[model samples]
Target: MEFNILNQSPVLNGHSVEQSLGHTTELAKLADRLGYKRYFVSEHHNMENVIGTSPEVLVTHLLNQTKNINVGAGGVMLSHHNPFHVAEQFQLISHLAPGRVNLGVGKAPGGTPLATAALQHELRSDIDSFNDRFLSLKSFVDGTHDNHKVLKISVDTESSKPDLFLLGGSLSSAKFAADNEVNYIFAHFIKNDENLLKEVASAYKELYPGGKFIAALSVLLTETEKEKKAAKEENSVYSLKFKDGRTLRVTTEKQVNDYIKNTDEKIEVEKSQLDMILGTKDEILSKLNELSNSCPIDEFMFHLPTADAALRNLTIETLAPIHTIHKEKAGIL
Candidate 1:
């Protein structure tokens, strides 16, 4: 029942890069102070709305700002990078932060098709091949080079590799993560399917031999009515982007219906319902309790709303109690 923070450092509206970084760092610092378990940032490319393109750089900056909180990429887009290079870069970061790093990786290309192509360049491959490369990268991390011809990762520095978490919004990722024996983090917000989340987690657990699987949920919590409306508007549109690249905003029930009328894709109401963990503290906590009771989620990564430093700080303050409840339930303290 442990809960941590996962952020995309969203550049909402037309926020500058500096503003996004400042806001993210402030949130990380707040998370560290609030006794939240860890704070992870995501990776995206050419998404003007998101500033989390370089998780490597983000992790480095976050580590500098926070003392106790574990910071790493909620994932590096593994479908893009050379496995060997990714392994080395992560190993280096692990050395810098030691035990305070979590190396989460994802198979998603992460962004529009053009952006994906640019980021992946010639490294793109089918899901199977991409997963095979992930396995190769993991082997390198474990210091097992028993069968290698030329290319390999060996860090001269006196530091261990960070703990690995496989991130996904799909069942394929769950199966791959389980087979590879790494922890899994389901991107529930993007996937918008609670049943699928459970199914994936169940599959991972059934395949894994007593391993960890985390069901990371993205949430937007607020106190006041105005704040709540703003959050809903933000989340509704953000959720719509996953469908295709629709620009229409959807907040109210009517707006959601209207958006549906404009698009060919049927609106995933059940999945969208899963994203509305937005409300007062008690209301959101109750929802989380229900989620934990149904899903075998070990950790919950709360992706707080980030407009700027003030809003981000307000979110952490308001959401701190929920995180505490999760920690207490897990006996973390």
Candidate 2:
């Protein structure tokens, strides 16, 4: 029952700009009112289907409306943007939200390789430099470091760095996150191994010295049985796209089903390889509790596909109370 809530800023294809902005703002207000801890938007670019290319802009809009909910990138894909620019944007967010901001950084390129290359074409593509970039970003925001004297993130505050989290789905990322003292956010939706969650969490803790490990899950919660089943069916399709956006078509379920069935992979084997789940609330909560206890995460971020406001709201409404109770019992609330 004791955990933090992180709402995903998901995007859809059908909405107008006004509708998208309005829905996101509404979710932020609702999250604040519901006592959810933070709302994080993802960075996606050049995808005709996704609207979250500029999470900082979205964060600004949401912060204007919500009084309590912390808003920032559920992850800002560092691979695409300049570290300094990212820092400044988040610094501005921190200035606006103060103690209620977080900056979760992802090393993975969230878009197509072509798009990734295009985004980073001007910058060095040294993945190893992420560590340096992260350090530089922190220094810029924190206004610290003797060797490097840089402009403070335009905020002039010592604590403007905001809370930081290292996010990834691979074992390598878990190791790196642990090696560093930063918090770790395992994206379970992309790498959905429940056992791996426990393994990685333990590895992170062992190597971490101290700090929290956050597990993130992408889920859909439904009401009636019919609705639940329908949601599950729909979610399976959604999960396919989330996991692998390479599909040529979006409207065809047959393509997804065929892709799933024809893969040289067995169902269990493939499921283990994939990073998310599509199931009813009962099934979802069961797996989530397992990951929480097994991974012993300090917090859990729910990536509610933001396109469906109703389903997303229902997810938070139903799950927040349980998370709160669990947190209270565990003394984490």
Candidate 3:
């Protein structure tokens, strides 16, 4: 019943980017004090709502601010940067917070086509070579690369390597993580199919026993009907599947229309409910327990969907690990 956090640093309702980022920093410190396991920030680009464009910088700041709790990128989209640089960045951060840093990588572009193109303009590798890039990044992080031929990452050898996690929603991604002997996190908030979750978990476990399987879900801890309604209104997402087998998650219809207008590739748009868990603290805990029972989820990472800062803080406080532990000890959970 371990809990972690995935922050998007959304700039909601005309809030300034600095405000959003400041909130993220404070909440991360709160999560650390509450005994949460990890606080991972997402990487998104060219999105007005989300301002978390650089997760490595955020991870570094969070690591410096918090006394305990692992901090990292929920994922660094691998298609936009050089793998060697990515490995070197995280490896250096690991020295700052040894045994408390994570490096989760994903294949998604994490932005619109224009931003993706801009980011990758200088890189030699493309999205098609994501597998090879991920392997090379892993080798560099683990110090398994040939130092005689390739430049080493050159970090403190005594510092622990950042715990690697592969972030994806597909069974293929699950197999890929298992095959590589890395941890896997299913993006349940993006695509909440119960059967698919079970199948992916089973497949990963069958291939790599004892590997960590985490489910990242959208959650909203609501205290009133108005709050619940507002959260749901903001919770909806659209999954755009391109003809070339790429999928993009966008929040607004305007984004969908913009993508269609910008790209020449054909796409199929599917509006998703996002499967947000909206309820009181007790109800949310009950649903979480039920979900964990149904699947092989070793940990639950929450992606709070509300834009209201007050509601976000309340939700974090309500479900903090310390509160859960206290309730369990008192036999009231």
**Candidate 3 — which pairs collide?**
none
Q: After superposition, how far is residue 290 of candidate 3 from its true place, in Å?
A: 0.9
| Backbone Cα, N, C clashes tallied per candidate | 0, 10, 0
Compared with the true structure, the alpha-carbon lDDT of candidate 3 equals 0.86
**Model 1 per-residue lDDT at 298:** 74
lDDT of 1 by residue, 1-333 (tens): 566888888774455878767878888888888878889998877555677888999998899889998898888988788777888887888778889888899866565456665765675355446677788778777766555445446535345778888887778778888887888888776666789988987888889846677766656666789987776665544244435332222334554454455446544553243365777767777888898888677778887654545666665776784455756667884
Over 4 Å off in model 3, which ranges?
125-128, 148-150, 325-333
Worst ten in a row by lDDT for model 3:
148-157
TM-score of each: 0.81, 0.78, 0.94
Ranking by lDDT: 3, 1, 2
- Measure candidate 2: CA RMSD: 5.8
Stronger candidate by lDDT (1 vs 3): 3
Total backbone clashes of candidate 1, pairs 3 or more residues apart or in separate chains: 0
Q: Model 1: how far is 144 from its true place, Å?
A: 2.7
Q: What is the lDDT of residue 77 in candidate 1?
A: 81
- Output the TM-score of candidate 3: 0.94
Per-residue lDDT value at 192 in model 2: 51
Best by TM-score: 3
- Residue 83 Cα positional deviation in candidate 1, in Å, after optimal superposition: 0.4
Question: lDDT value for candidate 1?
Answer: 0.72
